[model samples]
Target chain A: MRITIIGSGNVATHLAAAFKNGGHRIVQVYSREIQNAALLAYHVKAEAIDRLQDIDPETDLFVIAVKDDAIFSLGLSLAPYKKLTVHTSGATALTVLSSIMPNSGVLYPLQTLSKNKEVDFLNVPLCIEGPDEQTTRILEQLAQTISNKVYRINSAQRKVLHLAAVFACNFPNYLYEVARRLLDKQNIDFELIRPLILETAQKVQENLPVEVQTGPAVRNDENTMKMHLQMLQDEPGLQMIYELLSQGIIKNTKDGH
Target chain B: MRITIIGSGNVATHLAAAFKNGGHRIVQVYSREIQNAALLAYHVKAEAIDRLQDIDPETDLFVIAVKDDAIFSLGLSLAPYKKLTVHTSGATALTVLSSIMPNSGVLYPLQTLSKNKEVDFLNVPLCIEGPDEQTTRILEQLAQTISNKVYRINSAQRKVLHLAAVFACNFPNYLYEVARRLLDKQNIDFELIRPLILETAQKVQENLPVEVQTGPAVRNDENTMKMHLQMLQDEPGLQMIYELLSQGIIKNTKDGH
Candidate 1:
C-alpha cells in the first residue's frame, strides 16, 4: 500500500517507520516546517512536502498523525485526498473529518511514543475506528502489520480511554516528578525508590489496584498523614494534592465496603 | 539471632520469613489476636504469644511491626524487652521510642509488602536508623542479612523518603484506580490500559520523569483538555484533579524554560 503521512511528530515518525518497514510505500511526508518534514522523509525514504497542495494524489491512505487540534484544519486542506483517510488521535472522533472525508477513520495507538526511543510497535495496542466495517477492516489490516494487539473502539470509548490514559500514564509520571522533587530537597537519591515504583506497577499486572493498594491512606494511619501534612504545609499545592488523593482513596474504600 | 516479631501484618509476615530464611531464630510472633499470631508463627517455626507479658526476654532483637499509632503504646508495654528494639515504619521517628527504650531504632523496608505475595527481599531497600553508632552497626548487620540494599538513613531523611514514597508508590497506585474506575464507567476493560501503565513506569526507570513527560497537558493542547473537562463535569472531584494536575504539568514546563 502507498501512504502519505501528514505529520512529523513522535506518533508520525513511529507509525511511518512501522508502516514502511511493514512493506508499505511512504509516498510523502508533510509538516509545517520543511526541515522537520525533510528529516522524517529522509529516514522513511519518502519525499518531503511543506504544503498540502503538493501531496501525492495516488496514495492509498492519508495518515494525519498530528495534534488533535490540527486534524480538522489539515483535513479541510487535504480534501482532494480524502479517500480512506485516518487520523491517529485518541480523543478526536471520526465526525471531525466526516464532512471532509466520508471514508475517514481513526487508528489510535494506545502507547506513549517518543521519536528518539525506538518503541517495539509489535507490542503497542492499535485502536482503530471507522465510519463503516470495511474501513475498520482496512485500518485493522494496516495496524496488524506493525502490532499484535488491535481492537475496534468507537469514538466515545476511545475518548474515555484517552482520559483514563491520562490518569494511568500522564498523572502518575507527574506524581513521580513530585516524588523526585521531595527526595531532592532532603538530599536523597530518587534511585532508592525506583524498585518500589516498579513493583507497584508490577503488582497491578495480575491484581486489581484495590487489591494491591497499600500505604498510609489505605491503612488509615492518621498520625503519619498528619506528620506528612505538617511537612508539606508550605507547599499548599502539594498539600492539597496530598489531601485530595488521600480523601479519594478513603472514599473509594468506603464505597467498596 | 533470636528474633521476636510483634504484629502479624504484611510487613511482619514478609520480614519474619526473610529473617527465618536468612538463618535467624524465630523466637516468637505476637499479635492482639492469638490466631493471627499463630498463623504467621506456624510458618516461621516460632511460638505465638498474644499478651505482652508472655514475650520472650531472651530474644536478641525485638521487631515492632504494628500500625503507627500502636507502635508507641506497644513500645511502652515492651519496656522490659527493649534490648536492640526496632520498629518497621516509614514515617515514624526514632524519638517515638526514645524515652521508652534508648536502644531503639528503625528498620523500614521501603516496599509495598503483602502477606500473600513473596517479595525478593534481596532487592528491597531497608532504611535503618539507630540511636548510636554501635546500635546503627548492629541494625545494619541485621538488615544486611535479609537485604543487600541497606542504608543507614537518619530519622529526618527516612521520613522524607517515606513522604516521597507515598507520592511514588501509593499515589500512583491510586491514580491507577482512578483510571480503572474511569474505564469501568465506559464498560471498557481495564486490561486494555495495562501495557501503557507498564510502559510508563518502565520509562522512568532509565530516564528522569521531566524528560519523558507526555500528554495533552505537556503538549498544552487546550482542545482535548477542554473536551475532557466537559466530559468530567459531572464528577467535580475528578474535574478538580484534572485541572490541578494539568496546571501542574504546564507550570512545570514554564518553570523548566
Candidate 2:
C-alpha cells in the first residue's frame, strides 16, 4: 500500500516510519515547515511536498496528521485526489472530509508519540472509522498489520474515548508534576515517589482502580487531610487542586463503587 | 533485633512480614481486635497481647503501626515500658511519641498499603525521624534491612511526601474512575482507554511529564474544550473539574517548562 503523510510533527513522523517498516510505501510527506517535511521524508524515502497541491494522487491512503484546526482546510485542499484519505485525530469527525472526498476515514493511534522515541505500533491501539464498509474493512486490515488492537469506533465514540484518555493520561501526568513540585518545595528528591507511582499504575492494570484505592481520601482520614492542607497554604492554586481532587475521590467512593 | 508490632492492620501486617523476612524477631503483636492480633502474631511467630501492660519492655523497638487517632493514646498506654518506640505515620509529629517515651521516632513507609497486596519493601522509601542520633541510626539500619531507599525526612517533609503520593497515586485513580464513569454513561467499554493510560504513565517515567504533556488542555484548544463541556452538561461537578484542570494545564504550560 502506498501512503502520503500530511504534517511532519511527532505523530506523522512516528506513523510514517511504522507504516514504512510494516512494508507499506510512503509516497509523499507534507508539512507547513519545509525542513520538518524534508527531515521525515528523508527517512521514509518519500517526496517532501511543502504544498498540498504537490501531494501524490496515486497513493492508496492520504493521512492528514495535522493540527485539529488545519484538518478541514487540508482535507479541502486534497479534495481533488479523492482517495481514501483519513485524519489521525481522536477528536475530529469523519464528516470533516466528507465534502472534500467521497472515500475518507480515520486512523487514530491511541498512544502518545514522540519523533525520537520508537513506538511499538503492534502495542498501540488504533481507533478507526470509515465512510463505507469496504473502506472500513481495508482500514481494519491496515491497522491490524501495524497494531494488535483495532476498534471500529465512530466519531462520537472516539470523542468520548479521547476525553477519557485526557483524564486517564494527560491529567495524571499533570498531577505527577504537581507532586514533583510539592516534593521540590521541601528540598526533597521527587525520585522517592517513582516506585509508588509505578506500583499504583501496576495495580490498576490488574484490577479496577476504585477497588484498589488507598490513602487519606479513600480512608477518609481527616487529620492527614488537614495536615496536607496546612502544608499547601503557600500555593493556593495547588491547594485548590488538592482539595478538589480529594473531594472528587470522596464523592466517587461514596457513590457506591 | 527484637521488635513488637502495635497494630494488626495493613501496614502492621506487611511491615511484620518484611521484618521477619529481613531476619528480625517479632516479639509481640498487639491489636484492639483479638483475632487480628492472633492471626498476625501466628505469622510473625510473636506473642499476641491485647493489654498494653503485657508488652515486654525487653523488646528493642515497639513499632506503632496503628491508626492516626490511636497513635497518641497508644503511645501513652505504652509509656510504662518506655522502650524505643516509633509511630508509622506520615502526618503525625515525632514529638507525639516523644512525650510518651524517652526514645521515640517515626518509621513511616511512603507507599500506599492495603491488606490484600504484598509490596516489595526493598525499594519503598522509609522516612525515619527520631529525637536522638543513636535512635535515628538504629531505626535507619532497621529500615535499610528492608528497603534500599531510606530517607531522613522530618515530620513536615513526611507530611509533604504523603500528600504528594495522594496526587501521584490516589487522585489519579479517582480521575480514572471519573473516566470510567463517563464511559459507563455512554455504554462504552472503559477498557478502550487502558492502553493510553499505560503509555502515558510509561512516557512520564521516561521523560519529564511536562515535556510529554498532550491533550486539548495543553494545546489550549478552546473549541474542543467547549465541546467537552457541552458533552458533560449533565455532570455539573465533573464539568467544573474538567474546566479547572484544563485551565490549570493551560496555565502551567503557558508559563513554559
Candidate 3:
C-alpha cells in the first residue's frame, strides 16, 4: 500500500514509522515546513513536500495527522485528488474528510504519543470510522496490521470517546501537575508519588474505578476533607477542583454508578 | 523489635505482614472486632485481642493503624503503657500521638494499600516523624529494614504530602470513574483508554507533570473544549468540573509555573 502522510507532528511521525515498518510504501510526507517534512520523510524513505499541490496523487492512502482545526482546511486542499483520505484525530468527525474526498475514514490511535518515545503501535487501540463499508474495511485492514485492537466507531461515538479520553488522560494529568505544585511548595520530591500514581492506574485495569475508589472522599471522612480544603485555601482554582471532585465522588458513591 | 499492631485494616494487615517478613516479632494485633484482628494476627503468627487491656504493654512499639479520628482516642487508651507508639496516618499530626504518649512517632506509608494486593514495601515511602532523636532513629532503623525510601518528614510537611496525594492518587481515580461513566453511556469499553492512562502516568515518572501536560485544556483549544462541554451538558457536575479544570490549566500554562 502506498501512503502519503500529511503532517510532521508526533502522530504523523509515529504513524509514518509504523506504516513503513509494516511493509507499506510511504510515498510522500507533507508539512508547511519542508525541514519538518524532510525529517520524517527521510526515516520512511519517502519524498518530502512543503505544499499540498506536491502531494502524490496516486498514493493509496492519505493520512492527515495534523492538528484538529487544521484537518478541515487540509481536507479542502486535497479534495481534488480524490484519494483515500483519513485524519488521525479523535475529536474530528469523518464527514470532515468524506465531504472532501469520496474515500474517507478515520484511524484515531487511542494513546498518548511523543516524538522521542517509541510507541508500541501493536498495543494501541485504533478507532476507525468511514462513510462506506468498503472504506471502513480497508482502513480496518491497515489498522489491524499495526494494532491488535481495531473498532469501527462512528463519528458521534468517537466524539464521546474523545471526551472521555480528555477526562481519563488529560484531566488526570492536570491533577498530577497540581499535585506536583503542592509537593514543590513543601520541597518534597515528586518521585514520592510516582509509585502511588502508577499503582492507581494499574488498579483500573483489573477493577472498575468506582469499585476500587478509596480516599477521604469515598470514605466520607469530613475531617480529612476539611483539612485538605483548608490546605488549598490560598489557591482558589485548586480548591474549587478539590471540592467539586470530592462532591462528585460522594454523589457517585451514593448513587452507586 | 517487639511490635503490636492496634488495627486490622488495610494498612495494619500490610504492615503486620511486612514487619513479620522483615524478621520482627509481632507480639499482638488489636481490633474492636476479634475476627478482624485474628485474621491479620494469624498471618503474622501473633495473638489477636479485641480489648485494649489485652494489649501487650511490654511490646517495644505499638502501631495505631486505625481511622484518622480514632487515632486520638486510641492514643489516649494506650498512653498508660508508656511504650513507643506510632500511628499510620498522613493527615493526622505527629503531636496527636506525642501529646498522649511520651514515646510517640509516625510511620505513615505513602502508598495506597489493599488487603488483596501484595505490597512491595521496599518501594513504599515510609514517612517517619518522632518526638525525640532516639525515637526517630529507632523508627528509621525499622523503616530501613523493610523499605528503601524513608523520609523524616515533619507533621506539617507530611500533611501537605497527604494533600498532594489526594490530588495525585485519589482525584485522578475519580476522574477515571467519570471517564468510565461517559464511555458506559456510549457503550464503549473503558479498556480502550487504559493504555492512554498508563502512558500518561508513566510520563510523569521521567518528566515533570507540567512539562508533559497535554489535552485541549493545556493547548487552550477552545473548539474541542466547547464541544466537550456540550457533550457533558446532561452531567452538570461533570460539566462544572470540566470547565473549572480547563480554566485552571489554561491559567497555569499561561502563568508558566
RMSD of each predicted structure: 1.7, 1.9, 1.6
* Model 3 lDDT tens row, B174-195: 9999898889988998988898
Off by over 4 Å in 1: none
In terms of lDDT, which candidate is strongest? 1
Two-chain complex of model 1, DockQ on C-alpha atoms against the true structure: 0.82
Q: Docking quality tier of candidate 3?
A: high
User: Total clashing residue pairs per candidate?
Assistant: 0, 0, 0
By descending lDDT, how would the candidates be arranged?
1, 3, 2
* CA displacement after TM-score superposition, residue A34 of candidate 3 (Å): 2.8
| Interface RMSD score of candidate 1 | 0.8
Q: Write the per-residue lDDT of candidate 1 for residues A1-257, one digit (tens) a residue.
A: 99999999999999999998889999999999999999999999999999878887988888999988889999887766556788999999889987677888899999988776677888899999988888888888888998999999999999999999999999899999999999998889999999998888888888889888889999888888999999999989999889989988888888882
Question: What TM-score between 0 and 1 does chain B of candidate 3 receive?
Answer: 0.97
Give one digit per residue, the lDDT tens place, for model 1 in B17-122: 9999999999999999999999999999999999988988999888999998889998888777657788999888898987688889999999988886678999
RMSD of 1: 1.7
- Residue-by-residue lDDT tens digits, candidate 3, A1-257: 99999999888999999999888999999999999999999999999999877776888888999889999999988888888889999899998888767988999988877777777888888999989888889899999888898888999989988999989988888898889888988899998899999888888887888877878998899999999889888988888999999998999889987
